[model samples]
Target chain A: MFSSMTISQLRTLLRAREVSAEEVVISVFDQIDKVEGDIEAYVTLCRSEALVQAKRADALLKEGNAPDLCGIPIAIKDNISTAGLKTTCASRILDDYVPPFDATVVTKLKEAGVVIVGKTNLDEFALGSSTENSQFHVTRNPWDRSRVPGGSSGGSAAAVAAGEAIAALGSDTGGSIRQPAAFCGIVGLKPTYGLVSRYGLIPAAPSLDHVGPLTRDVRDAALVLQAIAGWDGKDPTSVQKELPNYEAVLSEDITGLVVGLPKELLDNELDPEAKEAIFGVANVLESLGARVEAISLPHAEYAMASFYLIASAEISSSLACFDGVRLGKRYGEAKDTTSMFMKTRGQLGIEAKRRILVGTAILQEDNYTTYFVKAQKVRTKIREDFQQAFGRCDVILSPTTPTPAFTLGHKLDRPVIMYKSDVYTSLANLAGIPALSVPCGYTEGGLPLGMQIMGKPFDEATVLKVGHLYEQQTASERRLPQKEVKANG
Target chain B: MELSLKEMEELALIARLYLTEEEKKILPQQISSILDMVHSLETVDTEDVEPTIYPITGSGVLREDEILPSLAVKDALANGPDIVDGYFRVPRIIEEEYES
Candidate 1:
């Protein structure tokens, strides 16, 4: 019932009594049961509870005072706490942990009557550029099962791409959300750092993390963003802006809009085909009356070093809470307290240990300024570079990732190479600007390629307007992998 | 690429991970590759730029410094495997100097 419909279409059908919320819910689970074994996109599926929520949504509609998101099923990234749901962040450490309170995003979604479908999988603790770091199971790219959907938001991206849910929530700390969305060919946004409330997101890094929307279409992403964007006393950093008029912004014309293409975004490292597809997108935009221009963001290339030094240093300290003390799974049996703490973290995956160790080292006396603080200074320069570019452009456009999705386990022996895959997406996060990844085209292998649009800080409306325009031109680029597979019994 | 075995041990100790000797052997290459990336930032002129530490700027988010109650001892111990006398119990820590 829902495979071809947009969220707007589904809402219309639901309100018109053309379809029941229960039917849409059943259709989604049928798809999940059909493809999830190979996709591994969902970490926990609460089928019984989801049906109950769907039923409740239907009842509220019947009563005729339904919430804005009534009957829409959405996936929650496992890292976003949902009061009683087991949110493991795809890590062994958080394996059985469930939060006592819902994250602000989840609470807001529920308040708007969006049915919680299930918890999506991710790289453990939202580290790693690929979902291979997940302790439970790696999420396979829906476009090609052998490939990875870029992560640490891979499961949320893959699930939305594969149509397991209408939309999903994913977090970005240094490109987690946008990279996966780009890899999976969906619309995903990482709001300006303080634009969305971060009250319940498990901290991978305190300052860089952002919670945003992932949807099959730009309109749905904007719709979800509208429902959740606001300041909260619970999240001190959340900006107290008026709830965004995202839907109104969707109609804003692209005519005469000034768009910048950074030299770094079109660098020599970008694959020829990827560059062509992105430039092709720019051409289409120009044809629609938007002016495309080239501008230089000199510090753009150094964003990764800046991201790692600052983010990992914070990760080292933020994760110190899991000393087998307050939260997370406990460790090896031993008589002494110190050994238990040691053994517990020892049980964490190799990737986690590496990050924690690197984080600690960067914060050490000799390396703190020479490495970490210098990186922070570079970050300031990058932010200024963006601020200067915004003076010449309404938005910045680029290929979201340098290349398309790569084969899974292709990066196991060489982890740093995987981190480089996020180069294009991380800078927007570091500069604390809103960025969106929209599906642009399919590679010859049937994998999707995406283009990213970044806008001024807290100006998500501008990003949404540009993405909505881009998505309109590339409407038929929507992808589905299940047509080639048999349904589960 | 020049991380000594001793430096890796010290780093691992500070990171709270217990790295085996084999893992320590692999450290220099990993650290070196990362430092290779860091070297690029060294050339950039950030002379007048103040460090952008926090993404969100705020001068004062001060609260009334009143003490707030925390979770009870039982709730605190809820996730612990072994505990005694209101403290999590673990093996005695070793006093080491990374064999310096």
Candidate 2:
């Protein structure tokens, strides 16, 4: 029950002296110990340190000096650095590597007295849409063990869904967080690109990457976002723009709010069930005094193409640091300089290699003008498309992914199909806007379906507010995968 | 957009990755498929559009170049596969070239 409780609920319970932080943390770990074998949600559990931190949080709570996240147990994506902890990014290359410093988000979480339960699994360097690409074990969807929790934030999403962690932090680039949140029945937010600092987050694609929270509900997402959302001197791309108190905007009236449903994103290719769920969200918003209308983002169809080119290009440049000379595991005996670099770098997983090679090819002297530069121009067009769409509405709505959670290994063999999974969700990342995926409804088969709410750049407050309102108005839509489902699977 | 074996090998080298013969044989196809998917971008016309290199709108912050406390040598070398005298130890490439 403690594991199922939201951050807001847990905070009240902690304040009432009804539960100690240690109890909540123990409860979470117990749930993890019970379910992790089946879910494979975590890459490494920080059990000892978490308990130690929980005890300290209890003391702070008692002294009335606690922050909102005091005593809450949260899982971080493996890619985010945790001081002295193995932040492997779910890749074998960094299997034994530990950071000497915590990521900016981790430091903020520590300052807020949150106990970090563990680092959750991810696609190798967050490269894929499913956790199947991880070098470790694949993480199963909590709803059905046979299926995947959509990734590269799959492990973080699954952990929160299964009550393994109260909430988890996940980074999104091309739908990593939102798609997983949709598949797992939770709220996952991709804050505006510059809203959260990227100080120590392992780069998947620097320009597109965003750090956000996956929570049981919108309020918990807001709490976690508040703690970690701010500019830092360490990340130059981080914006100095003031962030509105997300919690304050959640309950604001939506009488005049305009919700745009992008017509292009709702192609007939979408699963009928997902389309119905998304439209159902619009109806709910309409009943709540919000105006909903169809809008167009014509360039939405080109989002995937541009995203792959741009993201891979950035990845190729960012990952050039891992030559095994300074860090990471070396693959073979080094006989010479070229051999040493080549052998060690070859330790990257197949997906990582695929992206790197494609990225390398795109940036090649003969191809740069045709591929890299062209994609950047299309990137500008995509951003402009969203900017124009925003002129007619407060936020845009669409299905987070084409469908609900797919069976694990379904799209692994076909790289293109796997990339298509993020089609509906990647547009926001390309446009550098804020987006949130909230549980809109469920399939008749009982799998979760997600509705994406996207807003203009640096407009996370609006996005969260809209998601929170829809969540509040459509409480019946929220359904958890039965515990017995996992037990039976 | 089709990458030949030679091109794949060249790319692996650029990426500083050594591939087995089997990887080299298969990589051309794998990389080609991904490139074909991304080729859709070439269809879009953006003759007048300026490329967006950085999504975040702001110039880099200027800071005084001041000395600061940094990672300890031991911690820096903690994960290095081979270390010698607090420095990462790699194969003697220069020596090997000279000998060859």
Candidate 3:
């Protein structure tokens, strides 16, 4: 039912009585039922609860109580705490854990009348590049079931692409949302850090973590972001600022907008298909009258190393609170407390434990001065690099991921190789800039590739404007994931 | 740059996860390789640079202090791993040995 409509289109349909909210929610359920068995996209789907909300939305809209997201259905990445809903970060530790209260973003979305249909699967503790790291089972890509939907936000991307939901909320620690969006051929945005609140979001690397949106189109992404953006006192990182009308920016022309591309960032180690997709988008922009130039952000070369050290260190500390004594899984009915500690965490996936250990090592006093402190300086340099590059251009363009969706087990044996999968997207997180991933084309193997549009700090409007404009120019539009999931009803 | 067996075991204790000797053996190598990869920051110079421990940008976020009622006890305990007599309960702290 939503295979062809954007969020705005769905809102208009609800407003016009062309389709009741129940009908749309029911359609989403129908789609989920048809495809989830084959795709295994969800962790949990609240069919009865979702329908109840849908009926209420229909009633509320009928009574003129509709808000911005009235009747719109979305799936949330399970790591984000959703009150009364199971909010596992796809880790065995929190397999059955239910959050006590809604995260700030969830509260806002509910206030806006957005109905959550389900919680989707993800990499354990939001750690991996592919959904296969999930403790439960892998979420297959909608484009090719044999391949993975790039992850930690893979299931959120899958749910949106498979049409299980209209759009989804995803947390990007190090490119989780953007990589998955690129793999699924959907549009994903990693907003400037602090643009969205993190209170109630279970921390992975809290400082690096950002809540963002994944949608089938750019305008829908913008609509979703508008509702979720803004400061919340509940989130320590939330910023206070006036909210902008995101929808108003879709028509802002990008003609003559200086778009810079530093070849130093590209032209090396990227897959040919990925290169073609990026350059193709540049050609489109050039024809659209945007002046595209190449410049160098010299400090950019050292970013991947800096990103890993910082992210891993924080992951180690933030996850320390998950001892079985407080919440989540506790293992070893052993003779002592030390044993209990070992038993519980040993059950954690190798990847999760691996990061925790590495993070702790980096945070050590002996190493902190050499590794942690130095990474911070490198991070400052990386931001400086972007600042210098942005001086000459309004936005920076690149491939979101260097390759299309890889085979599920492609890099499982080599984790470092896998971390590089986030290369193009992580730089923005370091710079605290807004960057978006939009479908540029498909690889010869049929996997979707994405092109990234990065904006100056706190300037998400420009990213959306360029993405929506590019979307409007293309005749080809998003197709629902090949599999169809229908409600059990 | 990876974790040693001792380090992995230490981390397991801190994280409250148990690991067998075999896992301890396997994890050290696995963790070390990745650590070496992320440790590329050793090449950087951060002297005199302020460390960035947080991502939020801009000025004072200090909020006015005010007393507020807390959530009901039941609500607070809603997600606890285990409970007894309306309170979160855990095994007696093993202070005899391996005390932090």
Candidate 4:
């Protein structure tokens, strides 16, 4: 089906006029119609708007000057603003909040002539590792209906995997993008910090949050990244650096490339099957002419703890704007402003409330140095570890998650366990480096396993190149979850 | 490191969130466990290690000091739950006695 085709494949057909953009949109909507009820990946589907954009793309295609992403149906995580569309971060507070403007990435995608299929679900405020924290219904794994599509970008990952959308955008604060991508069996890239602008993203943790693409393959991710990565005047943190053509490096040779496997990251918590998959990927990389070596990131053990403190502290401050008077749902009746604030803010989901409370506590005068500043110092150590590791290798390789997608509700009540699932993925966010998760292999149970490739700051080309080469070598292992979906249906 | 219920309630108050009865009952333990997990940072030696607050290191970017078009009043107030005279309406901050 057209929905199952990659952007690279569709770009050729589209340019050749072999298929109309409307046909592609219709095909995607057909897939969505068939499986959306089962997968529950989308919070909102812009069927009519997507059709309208497809029509515009068809006109642009006829002129023979359309952009690469013309007519590609894509899903956007609901946390990223889309003008005039409800941009609920899966929180009841902002359930009716429609953004007045598009996020920088959204605007960039629109300018590229892509059709936005809809906004996908996410963890409330993008704070949780599982979409179960979402106030909305949980997004089921397309691979196994009984399993969770890893989150907070679970809906975006699941949609791309199920062919509901060709590709989607997800923001990674701490494994929000890569872990879900790993769980859903797709390519998810979190570009180096400052590589992508974050002007209109509802912040979960501003310093660590990164907007990136989740796609069917590495090439599509490169395409999307090429279109969106750059400095934006609106986002002060956006780096003023020249962006490399990400697609240009995908075919480059890795004959002398050095890949490091950090012993510290390969913890006892890693599933035996996942451990085997990591070794399997290392073997594939070595066979493809890349050198693999064991390396130590000594400070890696503290990344999770440091990340939580930093993330929660930032989330508390960022979400303070959602008072009852302005945007978002206003709840309860009160005679005083304090009561008004309490009533409205109290509606936050359990995970969000927990973070806010923890964040507030961490930033308090007595606890600031103990928790917040200390985490920041450890964050420096973690970044220094990556710098040291990169001195000996081109990229770091590890399992994206301890295991593959777990059964739904398995870790919902256990927030700490759910947080632990991000151990392999959160370090990249903390270090502000580029990380990519590509499907490595499958578990005996048919769940997808992911191999993570992390590179130095502003070195997305290297990361994408390594992931692409690995993907090319293991092309046989690439399979969609349609068979399981069909069985469930 | 375990927080008392009273302490948890105070933290919630500081955060401007009203906890439900269940949250009041469970949050102290939940927050305390999370705190314990993050307490691992205390073990790391950070002597003389400068804190890295923002990932990107540099001076902030600045734009020209020129007037630019911004959101219209209508658009700005469009999402407001309560609006009065093109302004956000909120509960009275000053009571009758204070106003006098």
Per-residue alpha-carbon lDDT of candidate 4 for residues A1-489, written as tens digits (9 for 90 to 100): 898899999999999999999999999999898999889999999999999999999999999999879999999999999999999999999999998999999999999999999999999989887788889889999998888899999999999999899999999999999999999999999988888999999998999999999999999999999989998889988888878888998999899899999998787989999999999999999998999999999999999999999999999999999878889889999899999999999999888998999999999999999999999999999999988999999999999999888888898767788899999899999889999999999989889999899998998999999899888887876887665676336
**Which candidate ranks first by lDDT, i.e. highest?**
4
Give lDDT tens digits, candidate 3, residues A240-355: 87878898988988889988887866867899888877788888888888998987878666778888888988888888787777678776586666666667777778787778
Q: Which candidate leads in TM-score?
A: 4
Report DockQ per prediction, comma-separated: 0.43, 0.70, 0.52, 0.77
User: TM-score of chain A for each candidate?
Assistant: 0.97, 0.98, 0.97, 0.99
How high is the CA lDDT of each candidate model?
0.84, 0.89, 0.83, 0.91
**Ranking, TM-score, top scorer first:** 4, 2, 3, 1
Which candidate leads in DockQ? 4
Model 2 score (lDDT):
0.89
lDDT of 1 by residue, A1-489 (tens): 495356888988888878988899899998887788888899999888989999999999888888888989899999999887899988877898877778999999999998888998888889888888889998988877888988999999988888788999999988888889988878899988877889999999877899999888889998899888887767877776666689888988889999999988898989788899988889988987899999999988898888888888888888887877767878768666556667777766777777787788888888888888898899899899998999999999998999999998898768678888988888987888899998888788777888999998888898889888877876766555445434431
- Fnat for model 1? 0.55
| Alpha-carbon interface RMSD for all candidates, in angstroms | 2.5, 1.7, 2.2, 1.2
Model with the higher lDDT, candidate 1 or 2:
2
State which candidate, 1 or 4, has the greater TM-score.
4
Record all residue pairs in model 2 with backbone atoms less than 3 Å apart, i.e. clashing.
none
- Which parts of model 2 have CA positions greater than 4 angstroms off? A482-489, B63-67, B96-100
